[model samples]
Target: MVKLATVPVSQVAGIGAQKVKELESFGIRSVLDLLEYFPFRYEDYRLRELSEVKDGEKVTVAGTIYSEAVYQRYGKKSRTSCRVMIDSTLVTAVWFNRPYLKDKLTPGIEIQLTGKWDMKRLQVTVSESEFPGNGGPAQSGTVQPVYSVGGTLTQKWMRKSITQALKQFGEIIEEVIPEFIMKSNHFMPRKEAIRIIHTPADTAEGKQARRRLVYEELFLFQLKLQAFRTLNRSRADGLVHGYDNEELRAFIQSLPFELTEAQKKVIAEIIRDLRQPYCMNRLLQGDVGAGKTIVAAVALFAAVKSGYQGALMVPTEILAEQHSRSLQKLFEPFGVQVGLLTGSVTAARRRDTLASLQMGLIDIIIGTHALIQEDVYYRNLGLVVTDEQHRFGVNQRSILRRKGMNPDVLTMTATPIPRTLAISAFGDMDVSTIRELPKGRKPIETYWVKHDKLERVLTFIRKEVSQGRQAYVICPLIEESDKLEYQNTLDVHAQMQHAFPDLKVGLLHGRMPSGEKDETMRLFSTGETHLLVSTTVIEVGVDVPNATLMVIYDAERFGLSQLHQLRGRVGRGAHQSYCILMADPKSEVGKERMKVMTETNDGFEIARRDLELRGPGDFFGTKQSGIPDFRLADLSVDFEVLEQARDDTAELVAQEDFWTAAPYVALRHYLQREQIFQGELMD
Candidate 1:
């Protein structure tokens, strides 16, 4: 039998070349793809008797035309209305801009109308029309699947083509899940589930079919993730670092601030990973300003104390330099050397840093993408730490790890990930989270204000600046855009300078050169520039202690996570910082975002709300964030199913014969064919 996935849609009985072109636009290419193209929603076209029909119900009613159609033309549009007799009662049927309905609804003609019945008007606003004997679903018990399509493909044609495809290839649709698991879950057979999903007898059956498919998607994803984890753990060449060094203990004791309980717990997890025989593939995540850097510092110290080099890679040069300075300060007393490598570093300095790194003189090296260059070599790279892990791609991380022999990897991020997304996106790695901020930290007071209050906000900023403090003014765009009505950074910079002529104002955006951005940030950090106006470029690890105010213009345009991150920029210092959200949002979602921001400073709670409002795709840019775009599975609502799938797959993969078992042969073959399994497991 020909495989459904191998057969092109063009080979289907009725889909011609033109139809194939149209289907390709919807991302449907193969017979399997055509069969799996599920509907976004369904319509109940089930025929109802006149006595059973209720007012305000979207239903289908068939009747015979009792009167001549009345047509009225208003400007470029026309209206057609007629009376139809259902049993003994008469009901009015109406259509807009449909002059052809007048001739179609002649006297004594039987017609079917599917639309809403208005109670007060005693009329059926017809959206679709059909004749009794035209072989349409005019009798009763008909459900229509509403697909997302366009460009020469009508719903009727799409339904017909899918029906034809199923008739030809439904039996050959192989079941990938094992039969024992199917019996345990009482799942519908794969073939029958596909059939019922497209043309179910009722809503209940459609729901059952959907549950089965959703479970399959999440289970397969979890299985692949577990397989990757198992493969990584099989290697025994990982370095086992020592964490009980006297200098490390002394350094921890000498810190100015105490570690939060959450930070201590996460540091313990990382220390445990470092002592294992296998490489550590761990993700350390926390809310912004949750003391993740201190925990990371401990882990890096352990690696260095074990007589091995450590590499810390970040997204931007500013963050790298910041980490370099702080770590140097923390480790200088302990005689641990720290090196900085960035794009803007002079060639001579970079050469010297590279030589020091190669000769093991640098105990810890911090850099941006420049760290991964060809010339940079490590003597004994034991632990690899990448901050803002989402900023770097999987290949870039793999390359950095490959610089040493099976070194342990630790990736850190300040963005709080919702529990469901963490499971689906980072399921292959061990996760450690820090949720509490250090003591003496003040919560940023947030307020949502209208645009008309801009002058008052400026006055507030002026007062704060006059008190010898600094402020940050953020905008959504870099320059003026006719397309988007957002306040731009350049314009905001000029306005701030004019608003407070005595205060030095600086401008920064992504479009600026690296050196200029660094300079602007330096001036702000040193209190030379009292007001720094910029875009979301300062959203991440740019920390200034004296900055006490963050004013966001057009705050409604940003997502909850982004708004939270921007707000986190301030409140890092001991001052009572304030985040003033300045915009009047028009949409309900925009208003809800502002409300959520003002209600809580907890990043995890905000993340949950963000996931609910924007979904997983837009939460972190699904394509770039390594989140799987499952067709039927929604991370927000299907988290329970996702948990079940993760557990089941993890248990199954732990079995000794999981890969070679007879019942899993088809699954193994599919995984291998999809490249979900590595070369060692290809047998």
Candidate 2:
């Protein structure tokens, strides 16, 4: 017999050609897909008699229709009212906007209504009459599962499809979980769990079933990562860029500023990793303005001085240009050759740059996504660095990694990830964090001011402008929207113009043309613009040391991480800086978030709070990256389970050679099913 997972949904009882589109819309093409579409919520159908029900209580009532329902008209409003008898008690059932129920509510008809119960005047009233035989048996009052349905698909249809998939093919529903794990975890068998998951007798059964599935998903995910890590480490050797401590010391001494202990520690870690023959997959994390770029430049310089090439891939054109200029200034003084190549560069210049890179004439090259082009070859590329690592997916990073014979990979992110999430998401990579800011970078004074104090903030900003300093005003929205009540960039821009008419004001948002945004950013980077009104586009790359004031309107509309990033724009120079959070938040959550920003400027602390507030999904952000997606597990709420799975999987990996192990063959097959055994990701 064909297994349930192998059966197609189209071959199911009621899923015809027309209904196939809706099922496919829900990402269900096979019977296994339909079975895996777990209910988001469940409905309890415990019976309650009419006399036993209390006022303002929701319940399921069983009764027989004693009188026919009528669509009685009252002024401009209409309704259907019917008298029902329940076990010697009389009650009324009312439905609003559903007058057609009159035809269905014939006399002597038995109905089970599940809805809100209220005492209207003198009689017990229940609205939202659910017809009998819709899903579960009403007399027995069994608990019901509510599946998510979209478009023309109904919940009844989904339940029916799942029923058909399970009943006819129940014998083919084989158990994939190893028996040892199932017994040790006190989990129900797979077949029993599936049955209860779809139609549980009560909430306890459903909870147990859901727990087993969630654990299965998380354990498989951890196992896959462990297998990939073991396989990935066994690849061919990488270029060992021997470190020169004296050259590094000279470079650091020549800099105008001194490196912090945090920077020195992380840099030393990188140097140690580069000396190893195996490929290095390390993630460098830090707060904004932690001097990550300079550390990277030094690492690349080490690779270059060892007679090898280096490539740094950033996320934007302007950032690439910024890095190119900074690198040229730093490396040229020591006779090191640096080159730039981007999509917008002239053809002649790009050809010359590519030729130099291939010929090893250029020591280090920096560019955007264009650095990984099909024709862009590297000569002895020893180190690969990706800035803003979250912006690149695993495949893009892999393609860049393949430019050389497994060159050491160093990915850098300014976004601070909470420790729990860092373990769950990036456990495969070695991590180094720059936890302290460089010396002499003054802390920006942060304040949370209500909307009524706007005038005082404007006055302060004007005073700062008069002192020959620039300011950045950040808004949550680019334009007005009926749905969102946050401040708009255009409205804030207009208000700034009205307040500081003599000052050069600029407007910037993501909706504007790229050239226009670049021009506006350039104007703000220099002293040409005194007050730049913008959105979060200036969150990551804008490096203006002269900008000493950052005023964020509707500050509660953004996350703490984002507010921190916006605050980092200022306090870059010696002048005292201020970050005024102007917000009139209504919810306690919003108010608390604003308080966190004002209480501390430490990003890692704020990130921990953010993880507590938003969970793991929003912690690393929605940006596509190498982090594996979890189908049923959340790292924030399920940290205990994640840790357990990590330890258990490590034990399994240590005990067996995955390919030939008999007891764990099912797990090995599952890994292959998920394509985790494929070596493309490893090599």
Candidate 3:
């Protein structure tokens, strides 16, 4: 009858200093953390009828040992095999590389063995087994929690540790959600939900437990986002631009081609926001070939036309340079002086640029985060545009905004985030989508190829190079690692060089110095390097239109969104482009993902498919994407729950008495804690 309460792991029984240290490595340092450490999957080992077992089926079988356990050693490895008779049927139980298990598997012991049954080998090679007197298989057909433990921490040890901790400290864990909310949501009691999740009597109970926990997680996250929106909306002052100049239209007309309908719509939205009384916080999202850059340029031009300076911030120097060049070409004709600020600029050049910026000689400034330095000052700064906006956190953007008087902020991303996530992350901002590619652009011809087809792909790249075209060879890793299965950029570059020594091949990765990266990218962009091997650093904002061939090694290792972005780097011009996804065809997941990329060029459609295939947490690299990470709820699966929570929180906040509510108080505390945690993590 112990009450369940959240507490530090130190308060748990049997968790000494050494165990606590080990747990911390896995981001677990408290009872609350341990309790929230939900299982990735469950092992249903409650069934025990030998006759019910089918070939290649996973099940649990209970029987008495019928023969002596046989131990065989091969080199340093050993395996224990024994015959167990259940209901007069013989089944083999085998343990690999566990020589000590031979002594434990004594004959005539009444034990339960759980694993996949290989009928062809007449084996039930035990993945898990336990004795009756101990914490054996809980029950037949029951769902058993399976925690993600380190290689050194066995499944049995994890279960034992958590069970012991729960027994001693479960009573002290207080439920965060109120009883009223629970009832309204039809959620089970917190304690009961935890118990059922850890030791469910059946699959149905497990599903119910999961539903309750997932809902709670989604609800809380959505509520927090809604509260943030309410707070910001109340405090932030809106900026109003008086002038409606034709500068944006002039810039658009100066371009070689006309803007598409989708691009035009996005530009209109930006113009509307810019001219509004309130400050504009907007996100411009488009697919790879979508004309997002042009839309952003139009917004910057609008700010300049209003007689105010504008700043464009990018994540890397290469992208900053690219943006600077593109903007310079577009703005110079209109007498707009665009300046580039990056870490690699010479001291004299930087001084001149900064002086010009301070003197209002520069109309638009494009650079990396270096633009946010304390020494960098702007004259009449009225607007800020960020590329790959997620690269900069909230604090970074806040600092940039402090440079101006509530500047109209416009952010752009090539990755098309689903609307639900956009609302959750940027609820206070207006969103604009550029859904159409520019006219005369061709979709990249995509294909899924096996490793054996590398020769063919290389031959195709060589042909493209011979025809005066550029190509890109991308890898997931920078250097070879013993842990990861993906290919490294360096190794792939070397191999490709060996295969085609005559072609100008260059290598680029995050590990390279700023100067080297810039040089390599410049070489590729200028067509000096025919084949560029790189890492994901090229995943955003690097435009090389003539580069018609893209070869991604270990394409399976990349998320679908990222893979799409990388593919976007090509097919930007009139010529036909091809994207080759090189992967292992034998892997079902890899094959299916690559096929999805091959079949569709639509970013939104691919995003949905990616979410459906790999869930929310895995779809866009959420953990590393700098968005809020969830424990129990999946943003992809709990989309409906999120929508409901958002609506409910919005309604509650609209009420005058919201601040007096107990739930509001608890939510404020939770948000403060989350903010601190996020700060520490980012640091």
Candidate 4:
């Protein structure tokens, strides 16, 4: 493998200062980075003829210009037009805002045109038009890779940079995967794959390279994740919280509603972990409407029954308070004392709660990250339950784990993570999934509406409010931005207040003070507010069963899974709930995303589709969401590889002398380097 430091822009002979800067913008500063910067797309222009060119199809054609160019100027704008005859067929080419193109394209001059053709206009608006002698169709036709570029970095410059970098480093690009794995998978050789990917001689070559590369990326990522899991399971201090039959039976009988088969299965798994001699690091993943909270309650009860205290940590104060209230309701019958601790809690209340917790006066403590505070000491803390676990980092969970004598951890998330992602991101933990929703609950009615239909939507919301039903209006941003035209939480709140003066509209966003957020959430949940205008802060754990409408502004800005989660906030009660996705109809991506939300209520399906459509980066965003930043692996495409990698890593680690293996040494070093880099980044 080429060392990252040895690869520099100057090594690419043709790279100048400006070109180097452009490459740097795409995070390509070294030869290794350049080689690893895979193509976002490829233009397979191997076959094309004017006669065979389908309308609206992107194709490449080489021909001589047979007619004089025409130029027209309308006000400040100018248009250039020309006709090219190829294979006994004539196609018009038009260029907007480039009148100089008319002079450049003289009649009888051989040129190559590549662009989407519009049959209705008989035009091929060339994305790229070049003279036949200067790198014409033949040169461009060879596997043309396309990089995602900003407006400042033109396609020509990107192509030139890649070409130069490949010329210098192509021969030196190293293959890391073992030869056996490559051969078993029927993958092309690394050097040939790189060459074909960048400059494929034909469409088939490009496809083959893409297939191999995508698989490789996924396979490596899975291997790394599996390795991490194997190492963790081996080293973690296992403390079995011996089971108490009396407490388990009492906890189950105390519930008002019967446990669903899925919930029962998950509870059994948790109990099994608690009884085992090994440390219980378990991930309880469930859909939004699924009864994960109740299962957690039962687990907490079980811990308390075994004479151990449990702490439940939530991401938001609203969720903390909600958990405290719900748990109080459930545990009250069993004489369990539940205390709430949040940043907003009064000093006196916090001091009293801390005193009670230390004295074993409080059996179950429900709080935010405040539960992890150094000043807070648990009397006999044994179980640490983290709700919406993705919102917390590994270190945060670890801190909680250290509070007791190797406490058992039960992390939970309403976001239904795919098996591959769950294994990689939470591979250290045993996983249990709650796949079923409650019996009486009905699926929400979802809709995708154009922004122009907002007036009607508002009218519908007013009608719902008149019927004593509440609604939630969610925005992507907290405040109105000069950069984007989409409505924000503050803007929407103000607009709603102005439009409906009698309606109680409240705004809640991440920027608000913790106390204020709690108050706003409380009002919305208790029917004090008819409408709650908020950002995605209410995406998880804010349950308002009375609310019946969920209107999302700029719905396209959110992933399908996230939108589904937001939709889950409503539709909790008996009345039918509606999710109105207000999006820009002009954007194809936006429309498609909203369509997914409208078509499906299955969180798993939405998550799978979201991963496939946006990839992991866009789905999680820059905040990382507690998932490690993967350089090469794509969770969507590499799921199968991840499973295989996990199995292999587990088996290898189970070997008598696995740690001393040569490949293991290198892998360990790589992981250590990645951890250090990640720590620096997080800092």
Candidate 5:
């Protein structure tokens, strides 16, 4: 019992060789592991007398076994039935599936069973039963923690093992929260919290235990984010560019379309960041078609006017080429050179571009990941703009920023997420949002078309294409999979080709070779392909303003935020755009998501709904490797706590010697034990 922390769990009292492996597979290798494995939920059961139990109620009743359990067969089904006597009242208990429980229901055995009261039949359906003579601590109270159990691991066995571990090693787990806070908040110590959480006397203790755990989870997360912030600022001295408005004004004036107030405001913010000594680590978030590219161009032009080169890093060659052409158009009037570098560039052309970049002939260079290649070097790089996919490709942007001497970085995301979630994901970076659509931009007409109305939807697409506009037919899958029952792009391509033989139909999916995909997209972008049958690969950076009609097949299979991104592909042109969702949602949540898609064009609203339904882990892409996986705290429900912890972290960091505090040391120790230590101090 005293050696629980450092000792291996295989050596624990009751564990055998076979059980050790099974427990280890559950990530429980040592006493420390077992102790930290908190329950996912709790079940309530209390001792109750038969007289006190009412009909249609569930209660724990103690009784004496009146008869041996017997397995009785009726026609094709068999059930195990037994009788228990509580005082003078007799009740029959039946288990439909668990015929193996006959051995445990022997006559003359004393029992306390948790079951539902069925007064009309005078029967109690035994849900869970445990014997007191089991070779482990009798872990019981009004509420019992239910762990996440898996193969060959019964809840009773796990409860017994965990109960034994708690009794043995409870003292080994230290209390990190200060004694004063624990007392004032009426929270038990970490040791006692672990004990009460696994076996709580009442719901209050369970709630208190969870509160303490949530506080620590959020506290550590804030500490880690703040630590990252400190490390980033101290990485290197930032390149400071002069504040110049004439060049930016010229570029803005040359634009044929007028800029919205949101665009103007974000551009000014970028200008201010460029003028500062510290490197700009900023996230630019604008709804689909809100003029983010224009802001990026304006910022890059500002960097160039300050007598330094800028680079724009996009995720794809198609998007990079589009940005290159757009930048050239923006900079040509002022005689600023914009060069393109992509894998598809001819070798000789790449050499020429590299030489030009080295000789400072190119004021701005735009490309895909090729921008970070060793051979390409900037003459005087001062700014790096990234067309991020909103998954926080932090490392991609970092590599591009490292191409310069701590160049100011601006990352642009078309996907609009909730403001609190944005803060959680990008706590180390400043954020500027553009929520307003540009002048003369009309909202896309969104509609939900059921399965039987597919013909009508196709007619609408045909009508739109007949008006000289293009269309995108998006399927949720690339190829048909036996596992998934949704339509795929390849089949849809064939269907479209047969249905509308007169119109040009092109196929594009992620499985296609990169060059082929690019060619297909090029054909679509240039209007040679009137209708492009594709998958969600076009959801990110593909832009075809002429494509005004979007028909999503199996629309219910995709998430709300993703559907919003798909809708963004259209509505870029002056013509009115239409997005028709082809769906047959059976579940209430799926139906609600489809309804939300039709209700609003606001990306943020869709993201908020997605957050509420799917949670933060999936909302953001997978967690970056360095980011901690919060075990107890959730960004959605714990937003207020996250804010408080963030404020507390700021105040704590401001102290002259905060790390020296005892409570701080204890907290830091816990973080170290979890392997995400608050970062080391700068040299």
Candidate 6:
């Protein structure tokens, strides 16, 4: 059979070069692409008897023209009105600006009229007409597909082009999924499903077609993930790490606070992954300030005890420095050496750290992208931990992993993602979530206030600072913009400085140099700066325990998850922290966001709501997070199907003959041709 995927759209009867260009604008280059461009909606234009129609009902009825259609013009406007008989009931049909329709609506000619019915006048305001006697397209009694079109492409033209393509190459729309799997799931054939989706007989058939398509899309996606898992395991020379040691136990017992049950469970899961013969590919996600650092410390400690060095990579220099200090404090008593390597490190210090790392002197090293530099090398690197994993690309992670001999990887994220998103986005990685916050941690008090309450908010901030606690004043922008009315960091910094002459106000934003930003954060972290006015550069990995107040201007402009992250920067200490959302939102969505922020502090719940409001594209950003932007499957609604596909693909890949079996030959061919694995597992 011919490969439908390679068959160009130009092979269709009506698609010329110009039409092909237009179709190409929508990313539809091949027959398979055109076929998969499913309609967003369908119009039920099936004909109904006049007796079944109700007042103001949009109905399609067939009738014979009983009266001569008269065309009349009133200066600029024209109307063609006529009488039609449907089963002995006469109804007036009116068409506006259709002077040419008068010639076609001849007496005794059978016609189909679709429009809204006015029961009082016994009239139909005709929007469309089909002369059944003249062999018009059978559109009167069919559910018509409506394509999202642009650039001179009409619905009629799209339908014609698609219909031509189906006619020419419908037989070659090969079954990508194995026949056995399809039969066991009671799924329809691929060819039939494609045909039914384009031209479904009824709504039920359309739903069935959608079911098959959705499942196929998710199944293919999970297949790639499964293949990656298989490929990664096959290529790995995994090391079995010894985690049950006196040092690890002493480290845990020496902590100031007890670990949460969730944290303990996740730590156990990580240990199990470490002891496995295969490399560990795990995602450790928790809410902000959920003691993820301790869990990670446990993992790093385990790796170090196994006579191997550990590597912890973060996204920002500040986070790297922060992690280095924390890890040094935790490992200092155990005589474990922790090194910090960043772009800003002194030349001599960098050289010393490099020499130490190469000589197995550094037990655990923390840094930003500098960790993946060509000059840096680790001796016997066994475990890799990445903080804020989404900030790094797959290649970056791969580079860091390659530095070691297939070191066990544990990726951590402060963003608490919902299970559905986690499953879809990080399907290849084993996920361990820590939902519980640390014991003795106080929930941040959040409030949404209007502009009038600014004075009160400032007074509250002043009071908090007077008590020897720092506060964060967050703005949406760095500089004031004429287009946007939101507060900016510089302006707010000046205002706060003027408002409190005795207190020091430090300003920070993305536009500042790295040194300046680091210095400003240092002042805030050390309590030298009474109030820090900044943009979202401090959104992640800024741990200031003394800061008890968070004032976000124009809070509605931020997503729920972002607001939650910003709120998390505070509430780290024992004092009751507070988050002030000073927003007078204009849109309902903005208002709802503010409401959600004020209502709850659960990051997972906020993530779910954010997904619903802004969709999956903007959640973690499809491009940045490597989440596939599926055409037919919605991660929000099709989560169950996603899970089922995940399970099915896992089972299928577990079979020894999955790659070479006769049933999977077509599937493998399609996968290779599409290059859906992003070249990661292509070999």
Best by TM-score: 1
TM-score of 4: 0.81
Residues 1-683, candidate 2: write the lDDT tens digits. 46666678888787799888778887888888888888888877777776777777778878888997878877877788888887777777787777667798888878877777776642444544666765533434878788878888877677777888778665567776666677888888777788889999888889889888877777777788777777676655567787677987888787777889998898889998888776778889999899999999988988887778899999777788778987899988888898888877888999999898898898899988899999998988999999988777767888988898778889898888877667667767778999998777888999999989989999999999999999999999999999998889999999999998899999998788766777887888879999999988888756899999999999988888888989998998889999999999899879989989989988899988888887766666664544556656666777777777777776667665556867777778788887875665432
Which clashing pairs does model 4 show? 143-200, 238-279
Q: Sort the predicted structures by TM-score, highest score first.
A: 1, 6, 5, 2, 4, 3
Estimate TM-scores for all models.
0.93, 0.84, 0.80, 0.81, 0.85, 0.88
- In model 6, which regions exceed 4 Å deviation? 47-137, 231-236, 466-468, 657-660, 670-683
Residue runs of model 1 more than 4 Å from their true location after superposition = 8-11, 17-29, 48-58, 74-77, 85-91, 117-120, 134-140, 676-683
Write one digit per residue (lDDT tens) for candidate 5, span 430-450: 789999998777899999988
Q: Model 1, 1-683: lDDT tens per residue?
A: 67788899998898898889889888999999999999877888878886687888888887899999999999999989999887677989999999976777888978888888986777899888888786755424588777888878988888888899889999999887777678888999999999999998877888899999999999999988888788767767678887665876787887878888898788778888899898888889899999888888898999998989999999888788888988899898888999999998998998899999999999999998898988889999999999988788777787888899878888898878988999999998888988778888999999999999998999899899989999999999988899998899888888888899988999989888888988899999999999999889898888899999999999999999889999999998888999999989999999999999999999999999999999888777445787878989999999998998998889888887887878887777766876865523110
lDDT (CA) per prediction? 0.87, 0.82, 0.80, 0.79, 0.80, 0.88
Candidate 3 ranges with C-alpha deviation above 4 Å: 1-34, 64-84, 93-111, 127-142, 148-175, 178-184, 245-255, 276-279, 391-398, 419-429, 448-547, 551-563, 581-593, 608-624, 672-683
Best candidate, lDDT-wise? Answer: 6
Give candidate 3's whole-model lDDT. 0.80
Supply the global lDDT for candidate 1: 0.87
Tens-digit lDDT track for model 3 on 48-107?
686777788888888888888999999998889999987788888998887877877878
Clashing pairs in 1: none
lDDT by residue for model 6 over 144-173, one digit each (tens)? 999999888999988888888888888778
Clashing pairs in 5: none
Count of clashes, each model: 0, 0, 19, 2, 0, 0
lDDT of 4 at 386: 89
- Rate residue 9 of model 2 by lDDT: 85
Question: For model 4, how does the per-residue alpha-carbon lDDT over 212-323 read when each residue is reduced to its tens digit?
Answer: 7766665555555555555545544656566578867877887878989999999999998887655677889989979899999988988888789999999888888888
